[model samples]
Target: MSDPAALLRAYDHQLRDEAETPSAVAVERLGPLRLATFRGGRGFITYSTLDEDGRPATQESVLALVDGALAHYTASPDIHRVEWKTRGHDHAPGLHEALVGHGFVPDEPESVMVGEAALLAVDVELPAGVVVRQVTDEDDVRAMCAMQAEVFGDTPEFAAEILLQVLHRLRTRDDMEMWVAEADGTIVSAGRLEPVAGSEFAGIWGGATLPEWRGKGIYRALTAARARSALRHGKRYINSDSTEFSRPILERSGLVKVSTTTPYEWRRDT
Candidate 1:
């Protein structure tokens, strides 16, 4: 796992196939792409690798694939927004221009981090008043989501939609778990652990902390809790799409930046 190339190979082999949409409500296929529809009018496009036929993807073929995926989502009236995920190491040639020409906007790219779950399972001492634990109750879940929104500056409507989706996942699925750090009965930090079925990878997602609560090991502790949970569920590897703030921390915690991922989004006009 220390060798960067080996880590990237392991990640591509074990994690990419089902990484994007484990909880998708419906899923379809378009050539090598998986067109996934989630509960909240969200659509996602992902594939393990674009070179499905032992040949690199050409500009024309990539453009045609992009158009086909968009057309499929556009035909579904309920899909208000769709995301076409692109990886830094992919062999796609005209993906960016094609997506832009087809009305897709790119988001900030994030590091695709991978490492041993055991490296993150160690005990980290939290601040004097802080404690981290997994939560399932509706009230705690809502508070966790609201705190994340405040920290990330998300719109109330967007936050509400995320809350509803989390609730639905909690009620319907057992593969995901929510964890939070609390001090004096208030949520200070929160995140989720998603153990991917039929894979050795578990994803630590939505790691957020209040500004005042950072630099006190609370976020790391919350991550450790989730890592332990993932280990208990029999997952060997930890993966995350990390922001700049969390990338250094995960790197310090033994995760390697295998690649980068950028999302190209397209929204239907209201």
Candidate 2:
């Protein structure tokens, strides 16, 4: 039997490919790597297994692929921010060095948490006037995106436009769903669940609650709702790119932080 870590890596490789968003724009295949493009001037790159995908492209070859893609995107002035998304569960041999060598700087490794849905589905008591609801309309989705921007310290326009694209996806395909908790008739907490096309795990993303509403267990409740939703779609596990704030909550809910993902950035000047 493969080690538990190996199983986790296999899962990451398959799940990411199946679960990626559609408006993802462009997808470039180099060996087993998937270098994808999305809206928001973003370039995302991921690999199935840095070492075990059976493609086994050499370190130098992988570096060449990164350079080729960077150069391709640099030709267009609109490509300002590129993210080389890495997973901690896989052996990325020389990925860090390669990315840095090509001028990509590493960002934080978010916690990747996954576990059974039953562990997270508990009724949480919000602070008296909060309500949670699923959103299927464009306006509500945009509003939720704007709120998330505020909480994460980003410009409202940046995320709203990005979410507009996501909304189009949600409308055309029913696989994606967004939910938020409303308090005093205003959204206070939110999250989204995306089911992978051919996998057993659904990715839980964009979870946030107002700073004032943090400790009341609203976030946990939001997670439970998403887990139950995932189960409805036949998904057995949930995964997330969690912040430190949400990590402990998820850990308490029985999800294991199997790996860490750090995003590296690069610019024309750098």
Candidate 3:
């Protein structure tokens, strides 16, 4: 699993496809794409590969597929935003042009980090007064999300919407675990662990730490706590789409950057 090529292969074989859409409210198949609709007017598009009928994708076919996927989400007026997840290693031709031509704006690329969960399960000494633990109560979850929104600089209205969506998921789902690092009753760092059912992978997502808490071991400890939880749930591998700040930490924790993922998003107004 330490080998980058081997890890990337395992990721493509195990973590892609329907396994990526476990929490979708509804899912539809369009060509090779799995178009997912989630709560709060969010739509997601992902696929294992871009091959059509076992043949490599041509520019024309890729454009057609993008249009079809967009049309599929457009038909549902309730979907206010859509994100098409694109992998750097995918055999997609003219994907960037197609997505942009269809009104999708690309986000910053993230490193697709993957490795054994055990590597992240080690104990890390935390800064004085900072404590990391799992959080399940409504109040604690809200605080964690609020701290994350502040760290990420989310707008008030958008932050409220994210809080509602997160609370809804917290109430309705048991597959995800929320963790936080708090000091003197204020949350400083937080993240979520999503153990994929019937797969060996668990996703570490939404990791954010307050600026003042950066450079300390708080985030690493929070990750270790979540990794232990994933191990308890029988997941062997941990995967994350990490931002620049987190990629180096995870790399130090034994994860390899298997590839890069950039999300192309389209808002309803656009």
Candidate 4:
């Protein structure tokens, strides 16, 4: 068995710097952080060193970084939400405290799963009458997003809006693909596969399924479809920040949990 941590290290060293911010409208550097401004009032903060060197930043430095990023986003009237992504394996001392002190609310942590693409490409038995396929049309994408929102307990309209943004990017980003599983002409599960530019890894994101569809093999079928797509794109590995519900499924499908990621978010005051 290959070491999961080693694979994660390679992913961080080779992909973290460029794979992120591929769709950013603007990007700037502050110390070790990459400040990215995206469409839809979103701001993202990430650093390759956070995972590469594992150097712990002093509390003061962390605070300064937080303040700088917040100020950068707050100055833009269109920017409303900022996410400071933190990895559990990073040696960031007092980082969480600094973020909270700076008014960032931390979201739930998710498992960072990594595995070979071939391991996930095996055929999965879907529940009878369920069909999985790649979807590109506006109406199909909207339906998929709505089903995902309901599955994840989020606002359907908001999810659809984000999917629309992603759809716009699809015109230029052929590396990204969306897949849905349907039963009786209604979307029951949905997910996306993002093959990182100039990297061996692809990411499976936003896996969701209806409550009535849980425990079946529909989600796994959807994942396998993405994995097969990744292989076709020449990707060797698959990565995902998975919730508890999906982590076990991926693990059973041969992915390994290498770390955890938590996002600290700030919302602009209207």
TM-score for each model = 0.96, 0.89, 0.97, 0.94
lDDT of candidate model 2 versus the reference: 0.77
lDDT, candidates in the order shown: 0.90, 0.77, 0.92, 0.85
Residues 1-270 of candidate 4 have per-residue lDDT tens digits of 459869778767766755777778789987788999877778899987642235566767777777887888888898878889888888787788888987899999999999999999989898889999999887887788777777777765456557657877887777678899999998999999999977888999999988889899888999999999999999999999999989999999888998899999888777
Clashing pairs in 2: 109-261, 131-182
Which residue pairs show backbone clashes in model 1?
none
Q: Candidate 4: global Cα-lDDT? A: 0.85
lDDT of 1 by residue, 228-249 (tens): 9999999988999999989999
TM-score of 3: 0.97
Model 2 stretches with alpha carbons more than 4 Å out: 1-10, 52-59, 268-270
Highest lDDT model number: 3
- Deviation (Å) of 46 in candidate 3: 0.5
How do the candidates rank by TM-score, highest first? Answer: 3, 1, 4, 2
The Cα RMSD of model 3 versus the native structure comes to 1.2
The TM-score of predicted model 4 comes to 0.94
Off by over 4 Å in 3: none
> Against the true structure, candidate 1 has what lDDT?
0.90
